[model samples]
Target: MNKEFDDNGAAEFEKLLQGVKPLAQDKLHFRPPVKSRKQIIENSHRQTAEVVFSDIYQPLLPSEGPMRWNREDVDPVEVKRLRRGDYVPEYLLDLHGMRQTEAKREISALIQACVRQNSPCCCIMHGHGTGILKQQLPIWLAQHPDVKAFHKANKEWGGDAALLVLVDVAEPTQKR
Candidate 1:
């Protein structure tokens, strides 16, 4: 069924849904909240001494909890690949000397080329400056519909100066 709503009708519908007449108000059953300050210390001198001791000499403790991060799961092959920059790239565009507008255009063109050429990955160097390029580039990159994922390069690569980008692989015939 086709449904269409006009401006006035939409407004009235919103008002009705919101119960703007105030006659349908429900009674809230929230209870009074409890408030109390904790009495942590009895004497100022004793408290100060305890605080100083705790700050200086935190004794070794037993490891009862498991680690939240996994180091062994890290792939050595992938790390080496990134370090050597061996990933087959579709295009490499340098933004080192280009202005902001020109850089954006170049990035867009490279992205289009990558998509058209069925490139799996690409690299972009934004440098570690005042974040003018770093900031603007990511915003545009994120907004790109063709971009699958993009991340900061590892230390072996350009590090934060470059990005590892994943692009949609186009059909074979579209390669340039």
Candidate 2:
């Protein structure tokens, strides 16, 4: 009777192990983390925050000359250098068919990029289209705190259709 019981148990165990296949290991695949994509989205959202180009204080810009401006603390020679094409732009943003809203967001992102990359200068190309962007771009650049100075581009840098902007990328020195 003991021999018969052992034989029955062994047969049952063998039946349970039928048709089990081993896992395949032929190819390697890489999947980037979903968190990486989420971070990218979050970063873009932060950069696209509403940058209010205030109308309460539009400085009377000359209609017939090269547009230029700078923060009160900035040196005038910075603007002169920009005019002479002494400072080459590290990045260039071209606004051709973009509407006002898109253009504004792009400008904001561009400034953020410049600040992040420690880029000292950038150029904005607002072509002579309907004159909408051309008129509004200087005001926007002037209002941005990061914009230390800007001037109409030199002939080699798109001339009257573009503006060279100086970004304040220097880390503030802490005092003891």
Candidate 3:
């Protein structure tokens, strides 16, 4: 009877094994925690295969430069007229030591606030970095949609290290 019982158990185990199917290759594959790993691997593999990078990847940057404006972009000699301290900045935000991302967001908020408050002009003291502001700030400023016009501040203001931005004032009727 014991032998017969063992034989039946072996038969049942064999049947269970027969019913199990292996997982699909796609399901069995593990994903790495790093997102860029896949891209990096593909890039490397293509390079080893003698495939040109252009075939697998597109350029990330545009060939064109930022918009350009001459003195004529604004009324002639109006900038000199602003020297009488007529351009009062209601809000002055100094991003002297903020991190790159923080500075960018703060600048955006400041521009919006200036507009909301109907402030005609504002001063941003980005300071003279060895070149940090020179590189990052300009990119942020150019990408900023709300910025009407900005230029290097006059020497009396802060010279090349700072910017004098003319903000669009909210219409009086719209200011609630």
Q: Count the backbone clashes (under 3 Å) in each candidate.
A: 0, 0, 0
Q: Using Cα atoms with residue i matched to residue i, what is each candidate's TM-score against the true structure?
A: 0.47, 0.69, 0.51
User: Clash number for model 2?
Assistant: 0
For model 3, the run of ten residues with the poorest summed lDDT? 51-60
Could you tell me how far off, in angstroms, the CA of residue 120 lies in candidate 2 after the best superposition? Answer: 0.6
Give the CA lDDT, 0 to 100, for residue 122 in model 1.
84
What is the RMSD, in Å, between candidate 1 and the native fold over all Cα? 23.9
Better of 2 and 3 by TM-score: 2
Clashing pairs in 2: none
Give a tens-digit lDDT track for model 1, residues 60-109: 32235310111233354543454456664556666786666567556766
Task: Name the regions of candidate 3 deviating beyond 4 angstroms.
Answer: 1-86, 174-176
**How much lDDT does candidate 2 score?**
0.82
The residue ranges of model 1 lying beyond 4 angstroms of the native Cα positions read 1-88, 171-176
Write the residue-wise lDDT of candidate 2 on 7-121 in tens digits: 9989997798777777898685687755788788656745553545553558656577679888889988888888877889999999989987778888888888898888889
**Winning model by lDDT:** 2
